[model samples]
Target: MAAFTDSDGTCLFNLNDGKRELVNGAEAAQALVDKALAGRDHTAITRICLSNKSYDEGAAGAIAEALSKMTSVTEADISDVIAGRPEDMALRVLAAICGGLAGRSLSLIDVSDNAMGEKGVNACRAALEGQRETLSALRMCNDGLSASAMEAVRDLLVAGDVPTRLTQLHFFNNMSGDGGAKALAQILPHCPQLRDLRFSGTRAGRPGSVAVANALAACPAATSGRFVSLDLADNTFGTEGAAALATVLRKQANLTLLSLRDGSLEDEGMVAVANALRGAAPALRSLDLSANDCTGACAKAVARAVASCTKLEYLGLEENDGFGSAGAVKLAGVLGGLKQLQRLQLGQCSIGTRGAVALAKSLEGLDCLTSLELNGNAISEEGMYGFTEALGAAGKLSALGEMDDNNAEASEEEEEEESEEESGDEAEAEEETEEAAADASVDELTAALGGVKM
Candidate 1:
């Protein structure tokens, strides 16, 4: 042990359990052979952070090589290494982790913020295809993985016919556009056990969004819904694409949480989506559809649909083109009927004193809202003051966590929801006096969830 430590080699300290434990494992440990290496604990010894300051290439190799000879470590955290700059050698170690089937028990592997190019992805693919028993979740977002790399991995997953065991995949802020989206579409049907999927900033426009949701909805995989939680925010899903997912959501009754923030959904698209949500899903809990082009007329249609989605918990409708006082008033009308809404967001939606007054009146009867956001719309100082006063009276924002949809109405009903607060009723008188409303684009609406920002 002393010789290896002195030689700057990786040392595995074994206890009564006969398992090797690395020392001072804080830095490169997770990256070295994260999936390959796991720990075994006993009362006689506890694993400590491996000292990474003096680490060398041999150290990484040693870790990977050692993985083949070890077994039985339940608590494996490899995110620290994935947080570092990519090194070919380190990725090799990563390859070895899966090569040795070490990820069998790995619950999480953080390979984010690294330049794990196509080669690295292939290596990880090899590991994932190994079908390690204990591997349950993976986060490969923000790793500078290009569209080609995603496509490459997707092809491998299909061609290899690997079984679906992984439940979580995070790919936030990655430029995995159309190619990546297509690749993922092919795999979504096979992965029957998926739980959390994040495709933020993947540039997955209309075709990809529509294709993926259609695949999921049409396949038996969706019916099983062993899968849950789908976050496709910032993917620029236009109105048409969003409506496609809306159809899927109708069949997926088990999904609990969904986020499609910052996707450019339009009013007509929202109308289609809202109409679908009224009776399709048997078990959807929360949804977000913020930042869309849903103006007053569109918001009214959506409000009408949400009035009947009894299981919805949260809703976000911010930063759209027509979500002004008129929109708020109509939304307020709908809020008057929702009995289960827990959260609501309406930020930067061209709200003014009249809108604020409209919202305040409709929300007065709200019993479940706990959080609220009115960040950047035309909600003047007076409007904000009134809005705040109403919230103080209501005592909640329901359960809203995020609000981002280019045309909040265009998202696939992932994170936004409906509620009948006092604001809904306050707008009734105004709504009765309203004039003709403009038509919204259905094509543009559904694609909003594809991350179409103005």
Candidate 2:
């Protein structure tokens, strides 16, 4: 059963324990609120979770009033509630709730996965307008927010009493279009302290993407080491959008992380990203371009960039069908230069025995690499054996995933035929066969290093 609890694991409200009635109406919500208010110990309850509940406008106002009384509450979660009240009443309830939070210590608010119509957006804006000084994170995912709502949020950030105070903002699965993106981009200059901006599955097309990139590009160098983290995953930002983002990235030299996973980025987009990374953005420590359309040529460009950025520590290139033996070889050539790299994910990239051999050879110099994922590849026992031997020599890897057994067996059979046709000495062939017999699966390679799952 799920329950809301404090930091010490004490349950404040056991929703499914059957000891207390479920909060489905104004009466039940008022009971909880009254109990907390009577005790005058609202600090004991830091999280307000009324998810999957049913209530009315009266309950919402009561809940908001109860929240206003709490002094130490930091997070509020009112998601997925069926408020059987008029739209205007709901708006008033939301407004009251926001008004209550005006001078509180609240920092994070989540009103996601609800049918919060247009008025809900205004309520959110009003709640945030006064709490801008304290609120650093806001999540309104899938709240049926429109471009007008986006514009309102932009104004809240740029024209509010405490602008540039927000650090993280999430707007996933919304209905914002080009106008919304443009509005958000216009406020980027005002929010100089922004750290994380996420917009997954928001359909921010090329025009919208370029607007955001342009705004970010215009920012001065971050006083801190990293400028900000940008996540645009699951958005259909096509090649044009990718190019625009690449241009901005080249200009923004202090960006620490960039994630464009599962986007519409193809080989051309990757080439642009690679160019942006080469001899620039030395502070960039992580880059996630997984599930893109990157191929061997794209991998070659990444290799050049990786060789130039010596401080890069994480690179995720998983689920790309284009990274083959050629890409692996190119990647292997640059692995030695990335001495600080700790995690490299290249799973399901179609790397075969030849590519594995090149990668294993390069592992000889990567002493800092702790986790490597190579699953779903056509790696043979021989190829895996080479990798295990390299890991044993370096003694740094802690996790390695398994390879395709069927593909490994087929490669082994072919190797036997080639061995029989070889014109090498009998003793040498016997020695090689003995070594092959003692070969270990890639999964067993991490037994000596800690047993870590990648």
Candidate 3:
């Protein structure tokens, strides 16, 4: 089933398979054209996807010819046609063909995952200008766009006589730094309908991030609480940028997903973001703040923010090694309230024995949790046992999907050494007492978990 007509009139043509059947672009284009022609109602094809295929200039022109005949294709996903190869000319031909469609008013254009550089942007300039009025979603991720290319995009938007109806814009993994970010920021106000914005892995630093955040704040959609999702992960948004984004977040009452992973937002910045998320984004469901260098110091604030988002389904706080036992305990206190949470990733946060026990206790309340990743948290065998017991007692062990890779088991020699130390000194006796207390707490937690009404 390489090609099929969706129920919503979307003609999806996928040629990405283990075996590359069509040797050249012309063959692929011919096959696509044949598929389209064979459809029950070719004229009703409102969307065409030629993604993950390779094409040359001539084949692109042939595909364009096919598209021109379709007449009803308002959305075209010509992304990844060259498959990471440099096919600037083919892209230009296809983009120009889309722009030249006499009767078509394209609303969505995705050219992502192609090695289209400045030349490709120049080629698509006409198409973007042609579809400016009706273009609602533009995705150009991983296209190797530079700052200069981004400037060209800004110019295209600026030249539009009226505001573009761009509701979603994804420019991920581009080499456009602060200059490009600022360029887009300067023209973002012209895109009043923009809502979903993804600029992750764009090499954007503090200045770029702050500029974008400020621009989003001033956008009509943001002011009216119409923004849906914002993904700025894998960028360098230090304290200043995080603070600026915090300000924008405060106004996003309707925003759903917010991802800022590996953004260099340390404890201070995360605390600021956590504070902003307290009551601002009530509709938020997916939040990713992993690898932000956050410590236990910010866990309380993060917990508060997480508690407020009652509808949250996914929470990723992985790779922050500073969130030790204390942080995990604080976070555990709030996990019970998130009844809608489906996936919770807390891997590599240094949440050791006691923290693991606390988290095990919270599992009884997470009726919807399907995946819980706590790998590399240094949880001991006792903690792991407690977790297994808790889950089994709650009758959710079968429903739980994934819980693996925790370094919990201790070697027999290590256990023997601990036993020897426990019999040696007064200090060892005190340590033994603390261990007993921890064991007692785990038992108490298990008992409490057994009583919870599932």
For model 2, which pairs clash?
none
What residue runs in model 1 are displaced by over 4 Å at the alpha carbon?
1-56, 73-77, 80-86, 96-110, 132-136, 160-163, 223-227, 309-313, 336-342, 365-368, 380-454
lDDT tens digits, residue span 6-68, model 1: 132123322112233432242444454443233422221112122222223445455545544
Reference-based TM-score of each model: 0.69, 0.69, 0.82
lDDT of 2 by residue, 1-454 (tens): 1234567533242122224333445677678666644454665656666565645666767776666766666767655554554677667656766665666666777777665745686776645666656777777788767778788777666664345666777788888777777877777676656677877777677778667766666643233324567777776666777776676667557667778887767888888877887766767788888888777768767776666666778888888877866677667766766778888888888776656656666666777787888887766767767666765666634556555532565375654454432323223323433432343233246565565655
lDDT by residue for model 3 over 1-454, one digit each (tens)? 1232466534553344434433256666677677545664656667776665666666777776766667676777766666634565666655645554545788888877766777788776655666777889888899888888888888766764478889999989998888878877877788778789888888877888788877877777777777799998987878888887887788889989999999899999999999999868879999999999999888878877886787899999999999866677767666776789888888889766656656666668678888877777766776667666766775556644344666667443443444333233223323433543465478689989999999
Q: Which ranges in model 3 have alpha carbons more than 4 Å from their true place?
A: 1-5, 8-28, 39-44, 84-103, 160-162, 394-454
Considering every candidate listed, which one attains the maximal lDDT?
3
RMSD of each: 12.0, 10.3, 8.5
Pairs with backbone N, CA or C atoms under 3 Å apart (clashes), candidate 3: none
Please give the distance, in angstroms, between residue 184's alpha carbon in candidate 3 and its true position after superposition: 2.6
Candidate 2: C-alpha RMSD to true structure equals 10.3
